[model samples]
Target chain A: MAATKDPRPCSIADALALVGEKYSLLVLREVCLGNGRFDQLVRNIGAPRDILATRLRRLVDAGILTKRAYSERPQRFEYRPTQAGLELEPVLMTLMAWGDRHLRKDDDRPMVIEHVCGNELAPVVTCRACGDPVRHEDLAAHPQVSGWTVSGPSAA
Target chain B: MAATKDPRPCSIADALALVGEKYSLLVLREVCLGNGRFDQLVRNIGAPRDILATRLRRLVDAGILTKRAYSERPQRFEYRPTQAGLELEPVLMTLMAWGDRHLRKDDDRPMVIEHVCGNELAPVVTCRACGDPVRHEDLAAHPQVSGWTVSGPSAA
Candidate 1:
């Protein structure tokens, strides 16, 4: 089936639509972590050949990734992130942290991501207005009439 | 075609696979903003009717969102985020900030999101290790052979 046209109300939706498949984010994450070969992504992601090919093509089309012919002998190709793709690192990290926290068991750490500064990484969300970290209780939504009409909950 | 299997190497991939369709994130975003009704999502998202129905069903199946019959006359339904869905707010906010920064023109602000304290909002990412805001330069990936193998430029 043809992919749906991206709904652009929010950039998150646009980004997700572009890379929201089962293997897409993993492919991007692999690329972000420096994996670029088609074989490497297939191996790491453990996806079927056709599915991997489609996801890679879509990433390249979206400017999140680019492929270069590495060798003509075996028809080899390598993938790399474009600037747009690199910008997605934070999002990837945030998702990783969420998954680790919510899904993974306490004893079994899936993978460890660290900074160059020799510190174990944690994902943090900061408030733009006060420049302080935002907790769940710290943020609330202000609704416009359009927002209110659509939303079922009263503004907190 | 059958949907691709969930790529298990990363949690982000899992999350995206579950609710990563064209209108899924947008619908989730609207729900985060308190917009829940069927007509409201249709107005906000502009997605196809069948696709929207499918996406909603998938989200409900995955426990990210729940559907309730809000009205009887026209058989209206309202979508609400479960805790799982509410947990996605940060991810959505992060994507919105990225879009505003990269996609919007300098003169055209698409929309303003305000925090409960009546402050205009901007989203920020910080390092979990140092308690300092993370910049592009602060992150680095170590080449571990066991994880996804990377073959691109060191950073991108």
Candidate 2:
């Protein structure tokens, strides 16, 4: 079945719609790691072939990834992240950091280390206006409803 | 079926394994927004009741959320984010930002705006060392295999 257009313009919801599937982010991880071929993604992500294929198509349609033919006659293609896909690095990085910190008991460094600085990165989201780390306790959130920001709890 | 244990100590993969189900993140989003009650989350997220219950239990088991009795007698409880769960705000914020920038086309603001800044929050994952925004093209990623940082391409 095809995905339907969203009725509301919500960022978190939209983001989930893009990468909420079981293996979507894993597939993106493989592509980000320069493993672009279908077989390579399947091997790395451990997804069923058909599920991987469907995710690839959805990601391509979503503009997060692009497909390019690497070989002719036999028709082999490689998937590469677009500029949009590249921007999702923070999400992936933060998730990794969170997992390493909370979920796993890893003494070793986590996967995907940054080369710019030799330090293992711990991502913190800061407020752009006042330069404070955004925390749920400190901030009061207002959800937008009917073109106005309404004060209430919202996730969708 | 039970979720399989990951052999590797990769944080990102482990994190995904915890929350990669269809409605898990959505459920987390609900809790993050302070919608603690079951009916409230159900109303906001629109997941099946059974699925939402399962997601909630998984989240609690993963220590991302905690359940506390809010009402007496009948035994009603509310879910709240732990320190680890609160740390996931960055992931949720980045996903929201990504969705707004790439997925949706509404001229209005996309999601829950922090009351601290009147401006819409734009979360950027910056290097802890240099304070520059991390980008995929700028990052040279290395995968951790057998406790070694092997070089590869990364988004940030």
Candidate 3:
């Protein structure tokens, strides 16, 4: 077998390999927002038709989405998130909140989410075990891959 | 002026427009991991040299990273995250956590994080005001753009 080039395997890299294609997350955004039909996704996401179709197919194949026939006459289908895909919603929420804070002024934000708490949702990432906000400085990384360290591949 | 397309604005789309390019988030990952030198990023990220160079330049231009001169003779530089860039670490964390959960088995996971509370960090998105875990069924989205609704564009 060919020698493993990057022995430091990363799940982030793996996840991106699956959904990092252009407009993939946008498709998820549309679906999660209760617009799952092809036409709605095309209009809302504004991705080119062919590209949207491809991304949808890829997402479905990855099991992040399920396609079910919603129209009998024309066999039109709508996409729904699988359990795995629903778990990605927070990723979108945090990204949206970050963009809202950094990229746009309050009045110019294009969407607002309201949590069940009856307040405008401001998504924050927190550690599950301790309920502390996850910050770069407050965490340490351990490389689970053999021959690797947080700095880089461990010295051979 | 060219006709406006995608007039129903979205900050998520805007954010993705900036960082959603291929390998962009992975670039952020390496810098956040403190492996910001060009060669270290190239080796760790496994991106082609020219492409990685382009990505680094783009990230620098986008204000997510600052390039600082580190070596005098050869004029070597390293990348560091700016405030906006640091804010994006949570997105990376959530993505990594999702990949770990959905894509990798327990024994095969590549990295683990330890939070300041001394437990393995499991990142969860929660509502900032109420401190409850954010879930799909417990939130409502209100479109801020005029002539738009959660389902799509309202009848114009």
Candidate 4:
């Protein structure tokens, strides 16, 4: 593993960098779903014990998760998402929707997301400018920055 | 490092399992912005060379990005986002908006995103059922399965 570099001081980057790891989202999803115990996360995600521990610690360090002592006998702790972590629910839902649409083996029956409104949900993006729902073709490249201006093997 | 375990069979889990790693979103962001070469990614992100290579390969495998050979003499390759990858631009834009609102330093201003209509862009989520805009608090939770329930841990 490479040394964890200090993240590019941007919230989106920080948020993604923090919860962007393979196990982090799983851990967060479980916690959001009300599963917070070490054993519960391990059972729910089937991630390794050490990896779960490290991810939980990282989440706690980032303030996305908080750990509370659950028992003293074995010094057990349960992880819970903070408000910041709950904010990621939308992002997770979008990712879930993408996966269901493109990667699911059975395209007809993908994972279901129910809105609090008693409605089954599908991920949707809308334009803030026009209050119009944005379809794929609705978006065109803004020329202020041309593709080639930022294009190159060495510009990243 | 811990062994990679098979995540849940759900699409959400599968998607998260794929692009949920560190620098993955950053890599995707760069690709969406049209930075395609390995050296450009390295220059933009400052991620380790090996890690960048691995991520580029993963993106290509996921169909979010495609690699094209641009030069035979230097044996150079460039990455471009496929339609699937372009669909994620809204998500990335939303993430950027969230970051700009919550994460920017006092002195630094993030780049502005404007629609082709010359309107400033902001992230907005829409309700698929009624085609109405949905606010964060307006969402109501409805569980499809008996075992799956929504509850706030803080409430408990």
Q: TM-score per model for chain B alone? A: 0.80, 0.84, 0.90, 0.81
Enumerate the candidates' DockQ scores in order.
Answer: 0.37, 0.49, 0.59, 0.38
The candidate 2 chain B region of ten consecutive residues with least summed lDDT is B147-156
Best by TM-score: 3
Rank order (by DockQ, best first): 3, 2, 4, 1
Interface RMSD of each: 4.5, 4.0, 3.1, 5.1
Candidate whose DockQ is highest: 3
The better candidate by TM-score, 2 or 3, is 3
Q: Which residue pairs in candidate 4 have backbone atoms (N, alpha carbon, C) closer than 3 angstroms, thus clashing?
A: A20-B20, A116-B140, A116-B141, A153-B39, A153-B40, A154-B40, A155-B40, A156-B40, A156-B43, A156-B44
The 10-residue segment of model 3 chain A with minimum total lDDT is A147-156
Model 3 whole-model lDDT (C-alpha atoms): 0.85
True contacts kept of each: 0.48, 0.63, 0.82, 0.41
Write one digit per residue (lDDT tens) for candidate 4, span A76-123: 888887777776666666777777777766654434655656677765
lDDT of 4 by residue, B1-156 (tens): 423343334556777666777777778777766677787778667789999999888989989899988799889988887878877766777676656554555625345555655576765776678665544444544343334444545454
Candidate 1 local lDDT, B33-148, one digit each (tens) = 67787766776778778888889899899788898877889788878888777777777778777766666567344455666556877777778667676654666654322433
Q: Comparing only chain A of model 1 with the true chain A, what is the TM-score?
A: 0.80
Give RMSD (Å) of candidate 4 vs. truth: 6.1
Per-model lDDT: 0.69, 0.73, 0.85, 0.67
- Order of candidates by lDDT, top first? 3, 2, 1, 4
Model 4 bad stretches (over 4 Å)? A1-11, A68-77, A108-110, A134-156, B1-7, B71-75, B105-107, B131-156
TM-scores of the candidates are: 0.77, 0.86, 0.92, 0.77
RMSD of each: 5.8, 5.3, 4.0, 6.1
